[model samples]
Target: MTPLDDGPPHGRGREIWLLAATFLVAAAGMVYELVAATLSSYLLGDSVRQFSLVIGVFLASMGLGAWVTRFVDRAVSGFVWAQIALGVIGGCMAPVMFFAYAWMGEVELPLYLFLVLTGILCGMEIPLIARVLKEVGAAAFRFENVLSVDYVGALAASVAFPLLIVPHLGLMSASLSFGVLNLLVAGISLWLFRAQVSRGLVVVWAVALCALSVFLVQSERMVSVVEASLFEDEVILSQDSPYQHLTLTRFQGRTRFFLDASIQFDSQDEYRYHEMLVQPAMALAPRRQKVLILGGGDGLAAREVFRSADVAAVTLVDLDGAVTGLFRSHADLVALNAGSLNDPRMTVVTGDAWAFAAENRDSYDVIIVDLPDPKSIALSKLYTQEFYAMLAERLSATGVMVVQSGSPLFARQGYWSVVHTLQATRNPFVPGGRLWVLPYHVYVPSFGDWGFTLVAAHPLTPRDIHLPDGLRYATPEVWRAAQVFGPDEADMPADVNRLQSHALVGYYSAGWDAWFK
Candidate 1:
């Protein structure tokens, strides 16, 4: 009988261990892939494109590794070495990419290089493990056992990734921790099959373990250095929440909040953005007793809302708990928003704005959709016709909703597309059915010629404008002039942003590229 039928006495037990190792390595491989994709999306824009390229390159490299495995003669030794290589590469992927992007102004080279390297190493791993298992009395079910166990591990990883790894350990720690797992898998496998391998491998293993241990403890230091090189100011706090990367920076007492590496607001002039976002809708609404804010977890808009005496109750729905919690607890952040989030009149709900709008039975007099710009497919959903339709259902008959449209001078087509989408939902035949929508612009020093869209079920005129108390920038005359646009900021006809088409993303991407790039 061949070694497949009659092997060492403990071969059967080793085969089970081999399957377990396979499960672990598969999970580690997926974690590395996802971590890379997420980091790329944070550094770069357009998550859909970033994830697609990383996955495609990784899978193809895996296939390449599998094909190259045909030339290997020693399966067990090859598998052990591959695991060590994968551990080091996967463990260091995040810091390496961050450094590459911050230093080189391009992540494409290192991103694909690591993907190919890790993919090939991961690809070589399974075939080698399967080959060794086949030689050790598991030949009859090697293919079935390996494939099934690999798939189960992948499913487990897919579930654990978002729920556990991202929220708790974060990208940097998760990568290092998985690397340790890879090292352990390799070390244990080598020890179990020591008689079949040479002694030189032990020295390599010892060095790698020591290096990884030191790196793991200093991961935060490395991340801080990388972020310092990348961002303009000193990063006071940088964390990876389940939803996005949150960074708070301070330069000469000027604080800036960035989500996914995109600046949300700068403290010096934030009032301009928040003031314009809140004032128009609150002023125009017939009643301001009930208000709904779709985003604005920062509480700056809530601060503006509290300025109106008519506001009895305010409901703020934002997806990220980290942000709202930060504003609530952080002394500086609390002071920035004038303690608006802690107001007894405010109720903070940590959930999806889209779902909250649909399920909410209560009608709101003024709804402020202070969401991020349509930079990705996920964010684009919030700006679509479908979302606007749901939003319309939650508004009182005389309510006005203000949407923060992107820059008209920079993203004119995108700005108008939001207006067109809201207009598409208007019903002209019924009384108070025809939606009266107008496009407006405000010039903030931080953001040039920013735009907003105002919508109501009935006709809106100067009579609807009611200036709130303690206003700094916006007055009744300013509110009237905000509706008028110059020749350069003229409105343009664009397709409505529909769920299927994602026209806004395309328009915004193209428009911003032309103006900014």
Candidate 2:
């Protein structure tokens, strides 16, 4: 038998407690990573950049924690006690971060630092657990049993994290609950090994764990305050929608829907933006017959198109059915779109626009590109020259197309790039086809101000537009004025947005940042 086996019959009891303690710690730390990623995507505005940085920072900090484990007091009881403490600290990490983000003005530095600290403590747990188990009579070096328990614990966390924890309890509650698990670990430690521990260490450990335990019960109201402060609005309803948190909030008589803290639509005056976007192109089109509506999942744009008796059928494609269903089923959302979604003239196809556009050909009379602003790599493809080229191939010979090019005065480079891209797109399909660019603007309270682009193969005919009988914002005069760009605003460089380099994205984002800041 091994020397380790000689100490006690199977070191099973010591190993089990060690696994439970570190398992609780690891699970809490993993959820912290997910919450941190979600938070960055919310406030910082880019999913790829946020997720990557959060992951990179967490990994680096974990490595540092393992390195620092070398200095932990070289004693079996000390190591076990330290694991218990680390577990408690890791447990409270998410709720503490949420409150810190809410109470503090600028939370980036402090948030990242705290994430790093949690990762470090999380990293220290396993080694300390193993050391304690070994000292308590685990075989001299039964690597298999130690690794097996660690793997089992890891497997439990992986299964529990997304399936049971995140969506059901949310990040704050999950953290607080894990805090209780840590306290339980500390309690078990005191019960099993109270004889070996110092009186002061035992007292302090018990007190601290018990104090943190109270936070678990009080977590909800605390979370509400944090959420309200961060949103800066009366949060009417909020839910974790798997993909993101879908929040409905109200401020100044305006209702807005937020997905992952990014505003989806401001309800008070979306008609102006939607009308202005869909109308100009329709009015310019020879006949807005078979319309392709991309990104206006709310059906507000579809309602505008249906105004024209000339439109045969409208193809509306949006990625998330949740967005479309909300507008379709919810009374508030249905009322906002003015019941256009119920119109028989529309066909809704829920799928990724990029992939769908690639499969079909020669089907649309007028294509209205009204997708969300390019906020992440996921949305970038829709704004690229390639998407426009596919759209160009799909359009009819005398067809007209208009794109809601984010913002012109502010997104000057991005705006001009779309303008030039459309200009480059016109070819012999219609020999007289000449690309023309028109600029327009609208104000959204939450977004402040916004812009659009009207592109056509031929100069518009006032008669072709043949607007639907009822309209709120777009008129013939408004259509004509939208094309008008003043002298001062004309100073932006005419540099075109090309497929190879997305320089305009940077320019537009920076310009908006400067204007807002």
Candidate 3:
């Protein structure tokens, strides 16, 4: 007959409160992990690698934390202090990383340091809570109960993070808000077990809570200042959509659009890019009545597509509605695209390009793949062999499809991988059961040495295609030179990008790293 049989007078109430604290700390721990992973992905280009490293390092640190808790003789005091430490460290993680990246231009050290510290603190929580629970509990199964509640809280946090937290509160506010929760758990635990915690510890908890509250209140301004430092131009629009962060900046009458801190286009010379992407396919296709544009949410490609009067109906599939909405409604953005998004011939679908291509029965005479670089898994799927096969199914017999491949000079292997993937695609209308691909590149001042791939059933060359009027950069001579890759920019051996392998992402990452890093 020990404490298990005859527990404290209010043992049941104590168990419930301790279990609640366990649930809260677990949720806060998961949120901090997510915030770190997301922030790293935002600052770094390769999301898959960044997320994998963050999660792996965090889980390992947690195991280390749990192992270290055995040295603590006082579980209640240990748990409360760990919570206080986590509250301050985890809460300030994102804002600090943001500022570090903005000012220092390198956050690898800070990112990993915060990750390891918060993960260790999070790891200590469960074992410490279990020990405290056993002191006042009636059964040995209290550990299992605490573990169950911890898992449920993690599930809740994972679900809410992508759906509610990131989109609504953003990374800065979300981290600070969860930090507040961590402090609340600490303060509540201190009050519940007042005899166990000293007065100094209680004062520490109060100060942490008040400081986090101030940060939460001023989180928006803090983010604005930090983000402004990251860019040279004045940030006019900064928003976090479900898929990615969309930012618009203006400098010297030129507007630039960025997604996840990567520049998408500059308004001054966007025509060079858009014209090269859209005009080649439109000119080569035997008929250009129906057109489909994928991933060009800014409407710049659509503006080029509408240049041809033969196009009767155009459907643009873009993942982010915020992007299309801005281009459609905002006076400055609309003027940039010449109101192409609001054109009567345009029908915008705010959904995934792959899903739309898979489900739709309509065939188009021209299809333009104007998506971003394969910096992440999400974008990598667009460059996969399976996705190209799907597009081939929706392509009319005489239709021409063009893909905006990455820079041929900078990302030579990545550019060739797109060509190889398209070449591997089997189309019934083609003679060899393989799509005919003609890889070409153009030099845009904003984005140097970019490439595009034109695919069709039959063999086609730039000489046979007709150039449209009112074009700024692309011309018959420019088209010919674009096809001629210099000896230095010659094709490289690469693997075809498939859904399972996503080999293109690796190629893209390696190429960019060599040049930029």
Candidate 4:
């Protein structure tokens, strides 16, 4: 191969353009992979499994594509066509997957199909670029140059995807934008090698570019249409935050909030869930002056906390600021939470619950854990014995803590595992140097047979609990009946959930799968 220095001036210019194309295409390919994995995790439940499968299939397909490039005799045309194919497939991936989930109720087949196709096309780009550079009389370092630029571009994509793309542009817009990038690379390639390429290929490139440009411009509308199809009600708000996708829907004067497609609450009956979660813990605690709530970003739990006149100050720690911000600012959402998030007694801290508990210096008169179900490892960490121990350290001598465990009927073992973990917690302030854990349940029409576990230094009974006035659902009789469980809902043998084991995630997944499937 002739060195680039010995090549014609035009040859060096072509080489530079090809290298730049390599960088852009590589970045676009990585973003496509991330978008697929993120969408899969959002629609499906287990994030770890979804991401691992996506990455594995994507990498394998790339290897297959590289191997097939040996059969290609026309490297320039092959590379150009590959870019167009990638541009179309990668760009339409999110919209198609969302529609598939909305209409078909399953995205597994389409998800894998797009991943394999996108990965293969991405894999074919670099080798074909190297071949094209060699044909243009470039230096022997052409392969190294292409590979290094490709890797750096991939690094840039990985960083920007979470920080910028998902948060700012969202999955749909990000996919469409990168699709345009691929088409632009193809158009540029056609221009650079116009003398050698066919005019027919140029026409194809022009059409693909125009079509992708239209989609990129209308990406937000496309997302809205797809989201509207997914929900039964009108989508009032649909947003992508750094942590997750949030969607708010309303129908017949009832509002519903969802995180990553899982229902967080329904305004019509959310008071039942919130009142049951907060009332028992507040009534059992020796004092209710200073309360700490974890993972109640919607402020529903805080609303219940404020119902008690003794609550002088309440601190809420949740991971997502978007959730808290929406509840604090949106008029409808504010009314649902009864304006508790904006109350002067409330101090909202946007941070991780585990980290907050680990660093907390003050003890709370009552602590309420209103987190989501332990469906993934990240959420499972909060249910682990280690996390419960941290919470134990932050509870005052006579304070009580309550955790919103999952469905007792659907996730029997999961609910009991939380109870066992809290009971095993060794707290020095308690009478026996361990917590007295009590498991209870409430039946909400939306969730059915939901459970909560209360932890305190000393024993608590139904007779010891008190109900506040104006509560719609929770009462003395309801609290007494919640403590009873039938034979089917009885506790099962379960292992302690630890950070390393993540036993709760497995149990929760298995239990819900058996019920839902």
**Could you say which candidate leads in lDDT?**
4
Q: For each candidate, what TM-score against the reference?
A: 0.95, 0.82, 0.95, 0.96
- RMSD to truth, every model: 2.1, 4.2, 2.3, 2.1
lDDT of 3 by residue, 337-392 (tens): 98999999999999999999899999999999998889989889999999999999
What are the Cα lDDT values of the candidates? 0.86, 0.70, 0.89, 0.90
Q: Residues 381-495, candidate 2, lDDT per residue (tens digit)?
A: 6777677777777777677777887766666666666677667665536675646656666665656556777666556544424456567677776666665666635536655
Clashing residue pairs, backbone N/CA/C < 3 A, model 4: none
Candidate 3: where is the Cα deviation over 4 Å?
1-9, 138-141, 461-464
Of models 2 and 4, which has the larger TM-score? 4
Error of 3 at 282 (Å): 1.0
**lDDT tens string, model 4, 34-94?**
9999999898878888999999999999999999999997888999999999999999999
lDDT of 1 by residue, 1-517 (tens): 1454332447668878999998999999999899989987887788898999999999999999999899988888899888888889988887788888878877878878888999999899889988888667674764877989988888888889988898888788888888888989989888778766778887787788789878889988888988899789999988878888889999999999988778889998888788888888887788899999989999999999999987999999999999999999999999999998999999999999888978888988999999998988989999988888888878887888899889998888999998888888754334556467878888887777899998888777667476777778887788778888888778787999998999999999999899877
**Model 4: CA > 4 A from native:** 1-9, 139-142, 430-432
Worst 10 residues of 1 by lDDT: 1-10
Locate the minimum summed-lDDT window of 10 residues in model 4: 1-10
How much does candidate 1 score in TM-score? 0.95
